[model samples]
Target: MSYSNAQELLSAIQPASGGTEIFDPATGELVGRVAQNSVADLDAAVSAARTAQPAWDALGHEERNRLLNLAADRIEANAEALAELLSREQGKPLNGPNARFEIGGCAAWLRAATAYEVEPEVVVDDGETYAAKHYRALGVVGAIGPWNWPMMISIWQLAPSLRMGNTVVMKPSEYTPLSVLALGHVLNEVLPADVLQVVAGGREVGEKLSGHPEINKIMFTGSTPTGKAIIRSSADTVKRLTLELGGNDAGIVMEDADPKAIAEDLFWGAFINTGQTCAALKRLYVPESIYTQVCQALTEVAAKMPMGVGLDENNVLGPLQNKAQYNIVADLVQGAVDSGATVLLGANPDSEAAGYFYPTTLVADIDPQNDLVTKEQFGPALPIVKVKNVEEAITHANSLETGLGASVWGSDREQALAVAARIQAGTVWINSHGTIDPRIPFGGAKQSGYGLEFGLDGLKALAQPQLIKG
Candidate 1:
């Protein structure tokens, strides 16, 4: 079987089509079908997770770390297969620059989680009482993931939670659930039965997982609206929650920065992964001094890139993963054009042939208050807003409802640092965007959602602290 769809994968377990369809956007071919998960299935996965969690949690740090490392090794060994599944299902360029890196990064995160050297610092003062703090796991985490990067996102949800000793019941986006199923197969080989189960279905499946009495924690990465709903449902249990929601990140190019360097940062931040990244640059604010030059340079760069399969090994761009997103990108771009925004570079869907792919688009004259600037495009559409000064750029970037990540471009390290301090996002890059490493803590400051993932801190988010005093 070539990993067609969720239903096909589930066929080995049960009989039913489940009413979900999976297609390859590049070819519009039905890759797989999924069985709609029912309430019974939810109960089963949760029960299995709950039953196995205690023993898994009982293992020492070394034992747990070993298991996690094993998973990372497997992922590294199968990077190509994983990347192909990811690109085929998500419609990203095959073997794209970032896809495989993301997989490798997942492996790195696992090792980092294992090697986190955090010892409880004991305080010995004049009148100090002895106390030692320790962190422990919250069993049975319910993870609701998005479709953009299913494998990496699933690893994001699993690596730390499992490292911390919590079991997982993941409900991936319906459109791209097959990758999760594929992931589950890899996990089952190393993990005990029921430690990590991919529960298929839709909103109802997620609802059961979030509201299930057995679930101890809920970690979700998806749209802001969906995130809010998950929070509301988890309130009854107050299930330990971690959310990495949508982002409308901005790139600020200061007047002092090199236009060539700034344009390169803008291009990758706004166009990589077909610009479907949650934290990829969606809004760009350029210094007025070099606006035209920057725009021309960005246009030239965008034009040279090709779109194709994420597994094709040669294609650099790919079609949008779904129809709804294609429409969203189209509407936002067309709206910008209708409002007198200049098409620095791009093809209007109205003028294009077919498929869900959009050209690397550059839209200028976009008001800071416009919908295109304020919303998460989640596509390869760049809306540049030229600002008079860094102060205005900072002001506008902080206005959005999401704040996952942002980039600041300039040569003055101190000045860029000072400007970066003012930006409301949690992760700010001085001269780069979408450059994440396992050694750092990653999360959003505002509505981009709470709870951190990656690094020693990432594992800590899944742990509970207990003070042991003598």
Candidate 2:
């Protein structure tokens, strides 16, 4: 069935027995429903995926690549309708780093995954003997995608696994399952039955899926706490896991950096997807010498950017995706204020507002010990802390338990690169932050979770290495 909107997508889904209602975060209105899939449904999906795997694997890499490209083509064809539904459910603005951008991202990643090839590596070629290392598909990949950037992140996990010939049973976040289900619908047209299935549900379904003995591998993108739980759950079955978890990523601005030149980049880096992005610049450390100037420059830029419902093309920033997240951002910012941090721009949003709309906020002169500085406020608020020097900035940036991404901004590229090396993160940027390429590998350091996504390493992560000897 073709799904042009949230309701249409909802109607197309035949969720197991029970399900939960979904709402539009931008309007606080009931938009659709998702199946609250039970453990039985989870088991059934795993069984089907396991049953489907060998046939998919037998298709070989070239055929797999062909089908994945077809799926990508279908995604591009349905991009407009998909983007509208994504905006409605995800609460990201229609323009300016919103639904269209995410849908485009999905197509790009799928196409990129098609181009990536994991050919057998010849280890020996002596006249007497020959040996090679070949990649083989793992069975029944269970992918759990998060609500923020739901479609793209799901594609991040789904594309590589399918391209490597693994059948997948995916569980998208209940908050944003429609877009993923709609995506599944589009792909189902091009793929074999049971090759790519989306099961919508809450935590119970996810936990069951992770721990299922039938599932050979689990790929999850969500909170670190939840990642830890999944790791624990998979221990009994010893499932291969790839986790892309929570990140309170930091961005450091050097004394030599031009505040005006970097202001726009810094603002978007921190506030993209309404700052719900896992790899977004959560905390910014600027040199004390220019910290005030940086804050002023960012504030000026933010003031011109519109914030409202996602459907409005004029809005660059939209509401927080849910009430729970909105509360977390509100409380953290308030706690910081209570401890004496100055609000450089924006404040606690009106609680009674029609939607969970938190303003693009910048908190200044924040104490290093404050929760706002220490915790991940995954919303449209950023805390700016002043550092004595690059060394101190690196120290503070690396101090966090979570290190998914970090950035060093300065006029001198060499100096910035030097500092970027010191920050403990999987991806470090010289002048930009949180910008990712499909060809580059991305994961986390420390508690940010493990296993790489994207690139050749990512493709190999989905496969087993088989060494052949003569």
Best-fitting candidate, measured by TM-score?
2
TM-score of each: 0.94, 0.97
Model 1 lDDT on a 0 to 1 scale: 0.80
Alpha-carbon deviation at 398 in model 2, angstroms: 1.0
Expressed as tens digits, the lDDT of each residue in 113-226 for candidate 1 is 788755665643345667777888888999888888777788888888888888999998888887777767765677777888998887888888889999989988888898
Kindly give the stretch of ten consecutive residues in candidate 1 with the minimal lDDT sum.
Answer: 1-10
Name the runs in model 2 displaced over 4 angstroms. Answer: 1-7, 14-19, 126-129
lDDT of 2 by residue, 251-346 (tens): 999999999999999998999999999999999999889988999999999889999988888998999999899999999999999999999888
State which candidate has the highest lDDT: 2
